[model samples]
Target: MQLQPWIIMATISAFLIQICLTVESPPSADKIDLGVHPLELEHFVNMAHSNQVERSCGKYVIPRVTSRVGFSYSANTSFYAFVNDDMTARDNLKFLQRWFLKFPEYKNRDLFLTGESYAGHYVPQLAQLIVQSKVKFNLKGVAIGNPLLEFNTDFNSRAEYMWSHGLISDITYEAFTVICNYSQVRREIVMGSLSPACSGVISQVSRELGKHIDSYDVTLDVCLPSVVSQSERLNQPRGTEKIDVCVEDETIKYLNRKDVQKALHAHLKGVSRWSICSEVLKYEYRNLEIPTIHVVGAVLKSGIRVLVYSGDQDSVVPLTGTRTLVNGLAKDLGLNTTVPYRNWFQGRQVGGWTQVYGDKLSFATIRGASHEAPFSQPERSLVLFNTFLQGKPLPEATVVL
Candidate 1:
């Protein structure tokens, strides 16, 4: 299986973490070759710089070509008219099988599947497939940040997270949980109809939270083009450290440029502009109801290391629910807590809390981080990533001399 001419591969070094995009595939295609666009390229570059992987790890490689299916710039819109988890997983398996055959160098190196948010589903499903298929890839582990493991647990936790973080009032919180929880709201939205009561509750919650607050990272400020234009703000120091709230806007602008697209060998097939997410893929909303925690457990049983980390500030997938689910999974497996719940360290500062179950399964949180932890708390997120890759526990408390 020779590498396709269209397949763009960027070799970093020993480490290979493929970012899994959760978009569905076209009905006609058994396997969709997901390309590395400029936006993702920028993301990984920032991640590498932030993590200082090259500075510390000598040589680090990020293979631009990921098996996880996504809408390619040149892909026909009508081909990927529908997508779901099961289909996406099958497509990913095929891609990985082909990828390994093409790049035999990565066959012996450590391969970790990593992604955030919906990747909770994609990563686990793909890993399970790999295990079941008995593929001989050196798959050491998997890590997902702010992942959606269980729909109800993940979604329902949002209300309490909002209230606890002071993003919503007590009254609003009560209504949000009782009247119309996030799960219900999501269900309604997926069904293409919102009940009046749910609608009112959602409206109140939204109004109370306000548009200025980013739900992804409640602590971070929202991007306001008028108040802080991208050009001006880029030169100024970010109040939230290195994170640019307007990076999405900047990425959209950069990727949409004719010169940039030509350089990356990417072009819009049917869409006018390159958006963060796919606009044409009609994904199966019902797939969200399918819990991947059990799939995660299956992977764990196969002796593969699993690290589920959450950014504490992420309201979208609250740490509380994730922690609870991990704890329950550990209990069900009867894995004693090898490491008790304690704060891990990054230099002198407290990074976040972590707990390990049976040494194989672990869960940790990145303090002051968003849904995309690395984008905000880069240094801390880097520490987590580095430690996980080393198969070591997160850094313990730093002792002052």
Candidate 2:
């Protein structure tokens, strides 16, 4: 199918999204052309569930355009939306307004908002817009993976996480808290200078963690960048049993291939090479200070199901911080604990821990999963995915036939 021209409006920044129905798809004359192994874009939510769509399941195909949080479009232009430091979540909502207007089909469908990392801010803000707006999108639920919800709670908790996981020493952890919190440390970084005290302690922390470690997934091995024979590197043994330490290496090589770009109808807007994150994007760091946890509460009050899941292995947005936020939120809302916290099973063995509050809100941990839980443990993540869509809780215990 030759592509058609898409009108370029005010563009937003770094995000890409693909939409696929969870229902099983039937073998039909017109099949959705899912990007193959070597052809998909890099830095995509790894092990993206859309790839698992079964041919036997009758499904609907929605355009998985490059998103700036909530904007959606067809895969016609590989060119990105250039957004600057001044661009806020409100600006993202404006772009989403254009997206919803363009695609009327999304009106009736259940819109479950989901994001990882930065989208922690984007996804919830967008869902809030849909809920408040006059435009009637079937905004169902929102899920965030290892999100940055509240700056103080999420960032400051790093000290405890670092200490609890044995990543740093008792003395170093004490210094981290006593000298200055992690948020202050990050603010100094954004300002392009660190205080002598901040620098000294940060250096101490780094030395303890070491260059070989991946703060993203503290247990997983860090990727070796100076790899030769790209194909051989792609085929080499992964650093950890559960996570692919070097998936980024393969992604970089694959996306840069000329054949791969053509197959996906992609083009470099002006750059010489395709990169994982947008080079042109200038994100507003202050937005991180703006709390979105209250926005999440608003979503739940409107009767939308909310699920906040964490990959237990991740350290950057550690499960410690996320779990604390979820627990606190449950209490603040006066939401009853429908299911007391307990183990949830994937098969015969335990998958992770889960709890449901007031039956509409859930929090879970994916054991040994990375910042990108679905990529590390696809099967287990899928089980969670199915339950999220069904508005059910993650099982407290496994049952035998």
Candidate 3:
């Protein structure tokens, strides 16, 4: 995918800040009329702004900011609902809270937050905000698919698992290990080596998987099930030889996507760039308090739901990391295990598992998918939403972790 030059340039100038003047204003506690629809679809439906890519779904109109002029958010390539990285999650939350307050339909609807891979970070951040909103607004539940909520534990395990499973090449694995081992070297490598590593993985995996395929864009999670199923059935000489190649392809794809790179740039822009970890570390305002999980869990206890899921084959943020994050929340809630967990999707073998801590907090996994379940398995994704929207426990097919 071709990213706009301005975005590319903005990425290079990662530390440049856009200034905003803050004025103290009383928080509006006004409630809006609950319309049939929960969102202001019309505001986005006929967006006069030319740079945005808009798509209509039911009463919803999703817009993508394709180019950055002044201040911008959303991934720049394809149109998906991407939160802005330039601002703190708190800021993003405040924006959404005010939005719901302004639009009455959203007040009583089942509000949700979702994302994949790096969005893993976004998913929890938004969830934290929603919990805060519940004190004042009507909120439902939050669902995170293959999210990257925990960095050290979840992220490291994902990389190692992908390596052991042969999804990433030995060389790439070594490169990752080196980059992750030293802070300075890792930053230099991430900034410079991301594209090469990503492109190489895509090429190698596509070729090894199918000769019939022409283009290999591993970034699209939409391509997985068919590719994985077919490759599993290929009775050729090396039947399982490339079975997991897509994993490596996905890893590289995640690292190289211009939008994510843009996020990293946004995170680093205008900060001290002395360390490689600076890209992520520079986003000081985005940091969460250690008690965040507990605070979020407490809010959920008040009748809201929290569902965190991971794709079985995801190497970026594996099932274990999600499990760890949930465990933390569970501990905070102080329930030995009072909530019920069950199957949430059909057709796929018990998509991982789920566990509920009372009615407020829940967790589940999507089977036969990667980081992005909506992109990889829309039908199942819809099933998840259907259950959550109705405020029902995930089905029996979803295992209890």
- Which regions of candidate 3 deviate over 4 angstroms? 1-86, 97-102, 130-135, 168-295, 301-303, 338-349, 397-401
Compared with the true structure, model 1 gives a TM-score of 0.85
In candidate 1, list every pair of residues with a backbone clash.
12-60, 12-61, 13-60, 13-61, 26-79, 26-80
| Top candidate (TM-score) | 1
lDDT: the better of candidates 1 and 3:
1
- In model 2, the clashing pairs are 15-67, 24-57, 24-58, 25-56, 25-57, 25-58, 26-57, 26-58
Per-candidate total of colliding backbone pairs: 6, 8, 15
TM-score per candidate, chains pooled: 0.85, 0.78, 0.51
Worst 10 residues of 1 by lDDT: 29-38
**lDDT for each candidate structure:** 0.71, 0.62, 0.43
In candidate 3, what residue range of length 10 has the lowest lDDT sum?
A: 25-34
Using alpha carbons, what is the TM-score of model 2?
0.78
> Which digits, one per residue and each the tens of the lDDT, describe model 2 over residues 111-162?
5666566556666766776677755666677777788888888888888988
Top candidate (lDDT)? 1
Q: Over the stretch 165-217, how does candidate 3's per-residue lDDT look in tens digits?
A: 66567766665555442222323344555455445544554444344331211
RMSD, every candidate, angstroms: 5.1, 8.5, 14.5
